[model samples]
Target chain A: MTTDLKAATTMNLTIDVAKCCGSGQCVMAAPDVFDQDDDGVAFLLDQTPPDTERANVDEAIASCPTGAITVVDG
Target chain B: MDAVPVDTDADTRTDTSSGGQATTADDGAAACPHLRKYSLTPPESRPLDEPDYFGELRQECPASTVTLGESGSSWLFTAFEDVKTILADTRFSSSPLTPGFPLEGAPGSDAPVAVTTMIRSDPPVHTRLRRMVAKDFMPKAVEGYRDFVCATIDARIDSLATLPQPIDLIESFALAVPSDVISKILGVPVEDEAMFQELTERMTTLSLTREEQYQVIGEFAAFCDRLISLKESEPADDLLTRLTHEQLLTGELTREQLAGFVIMLVSAGHDTTAGMFGLSVLTLLQHPDQLELLRSGARSWDSAVEELVRIHTVVRMGPRRAATEDIEVGGTLVRKGEGVIASILAANHDESQFGPSRFADFSIPEEKPKHLGFGFGPHQCVGQNLARLELGYGLPRLFERYPDLRLVDDDITRLRFREGRAFFGIRELRVHL
Candidate 1:
């Protein structure tokens, strides 16, 4: 349960529009972490998102419609 | 949308003013302090009804409130708008270190210390923890497996065609589809699948006691421990080995951290998909024309995935937090440290937001179903892309294979929502192909 996570600074969420299909799942799951551009593609509201929003992001990651959003950490 | 205007008294904390007994300023009044006691059903039943609890609470208290038994933490924020603000804001944190945490589904223990996981962390720790899993689950990473996922589902459906007479819909198709997909992705060996299924089922049950929770977790933990050891000894390109040898090289995840990731993937990934698949078929069966169109093979299946799952919020309610300091949600006051459950089922059914078109409308809504099935805010489900792979590819292929698929039974009410349920689903759904 206790994770020896190195550092959260390596965190960056990448959204692939081609693969995304504009399901808006990432936008729904973690609104602050993902945003919708006019074209309906998801853009980062905050790639390095806050801790409080992590659970929602996790839920979003769980809820994605297209599976377009992926979290990348070093 | 602006926060709802509160009636001042809604914010005042009430606890035994002078009298030692339960006090309602007046009977039938919607007082904030006693929100949890206001049952969705009259207090005569042995078990609680989940949908009614969510539906009733959403209707009665826009920003739902509850008083915990042990922790005594007052919860507020269920209205769709409030949930959005609360989960995104940083001021109110989901730092699991509640002053006195309510042991959800567990009682008889005072000052019970809550268990910790990535879901329990806040800020930097959460960021670091989620980052590791994020890499594997990203849509791009998951998208590569789409063809494989589609093949898995298609192969099973094809095999089902070879069978005689009527078969159980849930066992034959619904459950088989996702379990097969997850097992393949996790690189689960064919010989160990039933064991995998047994272990994962216990892993996701929220109603179990803390000890039972730990026991199931232990089974899974042990499985992952053995798995990692094997993978470490003999490296492979599978996810488990990749995490153990390659990605984990930087020491980002400890042994427990790695095991937690595996447990989450196995448990959260499979169960919800089974529920979602069953619910979608039920939704379609209720609407004949839509099922006909979906089976018509004229319309593209891409649009149907989001639309179907949005309406059938599989993971209907998710526990969230009011991240900011004293955020006013839907006009009600929720202080820092209070928990919130986003009743996505109500939000999905809201006529004010999602138009009142009964379930069958195939035309993508002018506004997509804003239901928070997966969740809203930072902590959404990581395995969602994989879920999409199942829904997007699986449903259409299903109809294509069985053009005349329909439910044999009319009364699905008996299979209605369970009491105090954490997951959203019906008991037994039978469909005839």
Candidate 2:
């Protein structure tokens, strides 16, 4: 029986671009889930990661210096 | 918030006695009684064991009115959430040219335009200027200087070892580290350190009259202009050279703009870090158990530095901003053109955010919460990563080098804080190694 990884861990990632000062803490913490645009504002690379990636996503949210990243559980 | 017309004349200002009591204006108009009066400069004395005065103010009135001497009154936001909101909100403009901009120790009219650089400019302009050198200050870029920083700290400590007992740590070590580090970064010659140090000290002196302050600032600008010219003629692998060679040549930056940038970097690069270094040492010495834990390797240096910054927030008040539009913050309506001051110290110590233990105790928590020590939002400290690297590496090494370090006076009250300065720090920390 194959388990759906996306269904198993439902998390909504949000990035407030206006608030992102490009400190890059989020990208550093979870490179797979977050990236920065040319202007250095943060953007979400993966809106929903597997449950196994929860730790990294949480770290990124917490590490964000401007509190620009938020994660909502589905 | 209520658009109170502030009288700028010092002589005409109502003298609210040091007891912090509400007094009627000279015209017999009743001043807002609820408006809490607290001096941000040399903040009112409180017991060392007790939380800072701002913490109490935050608990009582997170958004209250405060009079900053002749600088005029403004709304003070103390709650962590509100402070963060104000910092991140674009409506809260950083330009001193904006009407009702909250300024401390600056002339009311015709203030030097040079002073309004990246820190005072809003987006597009601010974003452009900040991004020019932002990469140099990032954590990865700052990590490249780790070896040089260590060597500088060791040299300073080694020199202090030969000095007499009960040396003033601020003079012997704390102040020198950042000064030397900034000098190296700016490509300043070792022989010219004395000149730049004197200029920076004079420029940062809050007690100076407006005229006197401007005079010193003018001299500093001239010095920087000369430095920029020298860099243009003989470029080096430093920040100034990089800016002059890359930005100025490309017409991305002008000469005056480059000088302003240099002034900001040279002054801010050293002053705030020096304040943090001195205060962190004082905080650690005050709590010997915590110091012991750190030395014993029970507590990580990273956590210790974070806790140190959390406990002793060097930048007491965030840069003043004028609300561009009416906004409700912490149940108070800050009207358009109203000035706002984010009480960083109060927010850093908010019990709600950090909990009772970590808020009160100096012990490093297992989980380090996000702190406003480096501030938040676009205008948050640009050199934070560099400052962190310096503190993280410098503090541990200093303690390890002098394991038997102790204060000359155990009484916290005996320590002289830098009164009237924008930054909060111990002026002269006498220590015996």
Candidate 3:
């Protein structure tokens, strides 16, 4: 069931680094999928995580103050 | 909701600072008594608590007109979703220079030019000013300061050991921790900490006349100006020096803007954290069972801090904006050129977002609710990670160190709120160690 869920989920994640305010809301929400550089600009640890991380990613997207993070489901 | 009766004789006055344009829809929205003349200021003397009217308004009229500074009526959004919508929408200008920006302190478009800081400006400008200092306040950046925060907190706690029992926590510990921490970060010398505290006290006092407030502001600004010059000449490994070397030297930031930024950082960083410390300690003392949970590690400091922040939102009356264009929020059509104020304290306690007994319950729930304690959107508190670090390390350790600490006066009514202040905080918490 888990494998099927993962197989069905194909998501592409992207961040507008310019729009990133460095509030770290993304890092707080999904540490596994998101990480910050030494300068604190967010860079994706996982550009596309399994469907299991959908909720976390969604939270990150919602929580990003600048709305910098985006995800497209394929 | 019942259709509010619009007055036939409506006051059609608009913000005079900009192109004086009247609101389009429901010109008499502020005519309704409850909606009209809704006082944004808290009760002059009371326990540190949200006004009962906030709950009433949230339940009755989530979006309504309110009389703000200088007879300016603004759309007050009390609902959780509505407040979030207002914050997230870029159409709402954070700049006081923008016509109809509903705040009293800062200059409007007509007033003499003051360099707009990150919190007061929108997009491109806000984006630029924020980015200059954003790297210094990110979670990872703040993480590196955890040891400094802990040591600072430890030193304050140790000092309390020598002071008399039933000492004022606000003076001895609460204010000192953040003051020291912010000083360390900004590279400001703490040679006269007492003088800094006095100035902060005067600045935060809401009852001060406009002239007195401006006098205090000038003095504070002059201090900041001096600090900027010092940073220019004697570069130190600090945030101020970084701004001076990188942004100032590169001509990305003007000297005036640099001074404004430093003043903004100190004002934002110092009192708010100090306020939170005093309030949080008071709250834990009030709830012994919860305090036990926190002390025993049954409840995490992070969650407790989040909950504490939600319950007692220190920022009394703002996250205000002028509508750059007409926008509908919570079924109310707020017209272009009108101002709006999001009641974050009310939104934090809204039962809809936080579930039942949000007002009464102060526990860490299974699914933690997203709160606007540090506010939301691009202009949210940039120093929040640092504030969180201060609270997270400061609170539990405080309890651990002084297990028997209790409030000197348990009477809530007798306690004084920082009346008429920019932020709501306990003025003085006399505690027995």
Candidate 4:
């Protein structure tokens, strides 16, 4: 039997509503982790992907592009 | 980062023209000698093989502001202090959407000689154009495509790692990455990117004869004409389709003009970032210690990204305007209908603001890394988000994979700047993987 070792990650990429200028830096930076709404604001999907996706998630943070978007743990 | 102040009236100053602001060169002989030690420019400006001429300038002419050729662009500040001031001043505005640099030998109005993607316009126009394109460049748009970018980069890196022939990063990773991304964004087939390279070369060549420039312009226009028409019948999720059918639905811009805009995106979007990719790798490799620090340090990738942009300054100089009334800049006054250019390369390297070690050395201050690679004010680059996508993601993976990667020959004499009016980048970069 497997044990749930981790404290469930409430961590995800957050979009700052006031700073959301609709320039999809987050999506462009990490498409795997972020997506645009109808109005083109960024939202996170499945924050905890497999560890293999870490490289991309790191890229998203690096390229948050607007120098605007950021990652957070709720 | 703040811009260098307009100081032309000093003793070392020479009055050329502007609304009366000019730059001066000061070689501090008695003071700090190392300030000019490690410039980013390669030693001599050669052919396409090398692209780091600015490093040599950084070392040799660290305090000298150069105004090369008859075009008369103000290479401006050498001291870091002045640059910060200029960047802060609202006077040094950007005409980010055009080819009408103060040094641009062509003619246009408050508008530019040519239509471009969002980066070339001054605001209100810059504001609108950027907002329209922002939907496509947002980080959200790139979601789910990380693997696509990763796969593309990995495949190329894989081939390079295995192949015996020396690999040129510009072609394999640099050009390929952006070409792949743009093709996806434009909904154009990846194989068709050859046409883009050809058209980009022809349209953006700076030294072309006026007649040749016109011919290239005509050809570019003709090519876009057909592409827009074809996309008109069969629409896609690409930028061209949105601009043609959807964005135009609002009557904001015309199809003919929109075609020009597409050219700007393809040309500006791909070329600057692609060249920058190669340049970033080259610069980092030049300082292997920095690469190692980047690999091991827990410092943020955004810091590295900002530093990369600040150091390399992908688009070295951007165009600007006189606006309706005459404006002042690095000294000397002129009437209306004049132009100016801001040297990003010079400003980024200025030694006054950043401690000599703080900028190039990755192990320094982990706080706010000042950089203008995204530019300032109304006309900051609209595609900055996408450009960072390549750098921020691609660099770390590159380091992780080819930890020992470096330039084969360490001679500054051999490097040459790419030939074009648009962006300063290498034509080719051969490396030992």
| Candidate of highest lDDT | 3
Between prediction 1 and prediction 3, which has the larger lDDT? 3
Runs off by more than 4 Å, candidate 3: A1-7, B1-33, B40-46, B105-115, B355-361
The candidate that wins on DockQ is: 3
lDDT of 1 by residue, B1-433 (tens): 1111111112122222110111122334455542563222211231112334555555665664554333243354445655565555545455435432233332211111213345555555655565555656665567678888888888888887676646566667777787887777766666666676677555444445546656767777788778778778887677777778854566877777677667667667777887777777777666676566555654445555666666666654345343334456555555444455445555655545555423434344433455666665456666776887788777777877887887777654444343333445554566667
Q: How would the candidate models be sorted by lDDT, starting from the highest?
A: 3, 2, 1, 4
User: Against the hidden reference, what TM-scores do the models get?
Assistant: 0.72, 0.86, 0.90, 0.68
Q: Interface Cα RMSD per model, in Å?
A: 9.4, 2.9, 1.5, 4.2
Of the candidates shown, which would achieve the greatest TM-score relative to the real structure?
Answer: 3
lDDT of 2 by residue, B232-335 (tens): 89999998899999898889988878887888888888888998898788878878888887778787888878777876677664557888887777667777
lDDT of 2 at A26: 74
TM-score of 4: 0.68
- For model 4, residues B1-433, the per-residue Cα lDDT tens digits are 1111111111121323222122331323333232221122322332222124344445554333333333344333333333343433334444423232343332221222354445445545655666677667655555546767777777767777876657787888888888878777787666778998888866665555445655666676677777788788989867888877876656887665676677777888788888788777777777776666666785666676777677656565433433233443333232234334444555566555454432235343475456666754334566776777777788888878887777876653465456434566766778877
The local lDDT score (0 to 100) that residue B409 gets in candidate 2 is 91
Model with the higher lDDT, candidate 1 or 4:
1
Look at candidate 2 and tell me the lDDT of residue B88.
Answer: 75
Tens-place lDDT digits, model 3, residues B237-326: 999899899988999988767776876788778889888999889888977888878767787888888888888888856678888988
Model 4 chain B poorest 10 in a row by lDDT: B1-10
Error of 1 at A53 (Å): 28
Q: Judge the docking of candidate 2 as incorrect, acceptable, medium or high.
A: acceptable
Q: What's the true lDDT of residue B302 in model 2?
A: 85
